[model samples]
Target: MPTKTKSKIKITNKKVVQKKNLKEEVDVRTPDGGGWLYSDIVKDHFFNPRNFMQYGEEEKFKFNGIGRVGSPACGDEMVLWVQIDPKTEKISQCRWRTFGCGSAIASTSALSEMIVENSGMKIDEALKLKPQNILERLGGLPNRKVHCSVLGDKALQSAINDFFRNTAQHSRVQTAGAKVIDKELNVTDHDIEEAVLEGAQNLEDLQHKLKVGVFNKEVIPQLEDLLRFYNEKYYG
Candidate 1:
């Protein structure tokens, strides 16, 4: 009986497809692609931006503080200008120009409104505004687009820092990620970054410009490392 037993055969065919809502799918490939739904605030700002400086109009405004952040090569650049009220020590006016995605434009527009709308926000208060505040004001940006909002925050901070630096308020200048690389000479990462941005590409030229490691050669290595990083970040 065992020798005569025939082998049992089973055949089954099925196709399984997992379904997902458009928003839930991550990196789904489609002809039309996918993207997040922007908030109404973002849409309004992108379409009708506030306090934006059009090209060739830089001379119109007498800006006391100026700042630039991000690079065109990286696909986002922002330039912010602030007019400080001498008596109030507040930001009298805030304007900006941006070359980037919708998110960047929207974020900057929101920031401009926040700055000048309420009879001008205080300089210290304005400086305290973070990327999250802009994001929240915009209702929300996609996770991937969150970085764009940071450009607005940085540009504002940079403008404030410039105001402080120009006013000889060195103590008030808050430089993010700036470290005192040369403790002896009081050289910081910000100094090296500025030197590189000003076209000092070589270490020798940078030293000549910033005197970063003049007194302490031991700090040269650290300065060089920072230079390389900033060069690649802002220039490359």
Candidate 2:
């Protein structure tokens, strides 16, 4: 009989396996490794935000149009300023301030750069800059962070409306058609819609989330209609 060849078995070192497992655990606890994967461009803009207004430097900016959105109580707010070139109808400068997350900062910063770059975009063209456009420029945001991108475009539109109003172009002022729900808190239908998108399912949920229509019984019917509408529109 042929001599049986000695079989060599390969085994992975236990220490190496333990080290790899530890690395995976650590990764799961970290932001990027925990699945909050932002694009390189988003990180760049978030870390080095552009066109942000320095506190107390607002007076020196010479901006003609100003706009604000979101609520402090709701945990996100943004203010934008624009300087329009009267002769060229182009946005000469764009600046902003936001109390929000990294995505919010990055989105607004990218938007300001977009508006002011290449000799600046015309007001009409700038008005057409949607959240999708900004997301495309930033390589896109996480699904939950998508709402943050809306702050930039909405604030920009408000600033444009301010510019139109300041220039006595009343006819050009565009309204968002947001119906107020709670006068004391200054909540609106838009707020309800956002709450629904954020997982608010019913009137009590809305009340707990937004404090909307709490004391305002008159708007309950309207709020319910809005809640149903949003639930159907978004969930379906």
Candidate 3:
């Protein structure tokens, strides 16, 4: 009954407005959508690593102590050399080479800087340098890459131990987590731990990476226990 009061509505045609094309700037360094953004310090160190030992330069350094860790077969290796001032008992120079990811390179570079800066850090103080300290100096590494940072400090500790041993300070030499697992290849429990951290999930994987327990059947039980322990400790 109210249809008698219906009113006419005006219809208007509106122009469709198109959005302007926006251009986004992309960084060529990170082509994969900015994957894993490293801090500027990390990037700088990675691009131009400090105290890196060039090939054939090791003979020229005259370092007082040398330490090596990890393995090329396991995908990461670090060799650290330290020159200590006997009078001051401070680390005068630190040089290192690593076969690893950018995080590893950057972390070791930062560590060498920390050791040699301010006329160098004391051997005791350098021994106190932990992975956390290196990470703090590095501005931090990614979670998965944190393991890579460990190699630098471990190698540094090994170098420090070598220094102590060289100085006939056997009492100060620390062999805390190292136990020979493969006498033939001189592989140790630490090596097995490193292999585990590098993604070796089982005995076969460990064997592939470190050749541990391959010929040394007697060490298999110990290797199994170590593998389980490291797996739980790192990836549990």
**Among all candidates shown, the one with the greatest TM-score:** 1
Clashing pairs in model 3, backbone N/Cα/C closer than 3 A: none
lDDT of 2 by residue, 1-236 (tens): 66677557766565743222211212112445654456678889999999999988877899888877775555677888999998899999988998888778888889999999999999888888878888778777766777644588888887886687568665565545667666655566766766776689999998886666777788888889999998888776
Ranking by lDDT: 3, 2, 1
Error of 3 at 66 (Å): 0.4
Estimate the Cα RMSD of every predicted model relative to the unseen true structure: 10.5, 12.3, 13.6
Give the TM-scores of the predictions, in the order they appear: 0.70, 0.62, 0.63
Flag clash pairs in model 1: none
lDDT of 1 by residue, 1-236 (tens): 56766578655575756442222322323456453367667889999999998788788888888877776767888889999886798888878989899888898999999989878999888888888788778777766777654588788887887776567665676756667676554456766675676677878998776555766788877777887888887767
Model 2 global lDDT (CA atoms, 0 to 1): 0.77
Off by over 4 Å in 2: 1-36, 176-236
For residues 7-101, write the lDDT of model 3, one tens digit per residue. 78755787855332112221224666665467678899999999998889877888888777876655778888999988899999988988888
Q: What is candidate 1's local distance difference test score?
A: 0.76
Deviating ranges (above 4 Å) for candidate 1: 1-36, 181-191, 198-229, 232-236
How high a TM-score does candidate 3 get? 0.63
Global lDDT scores for all candidate models: 0.76, 0.77, 0.77
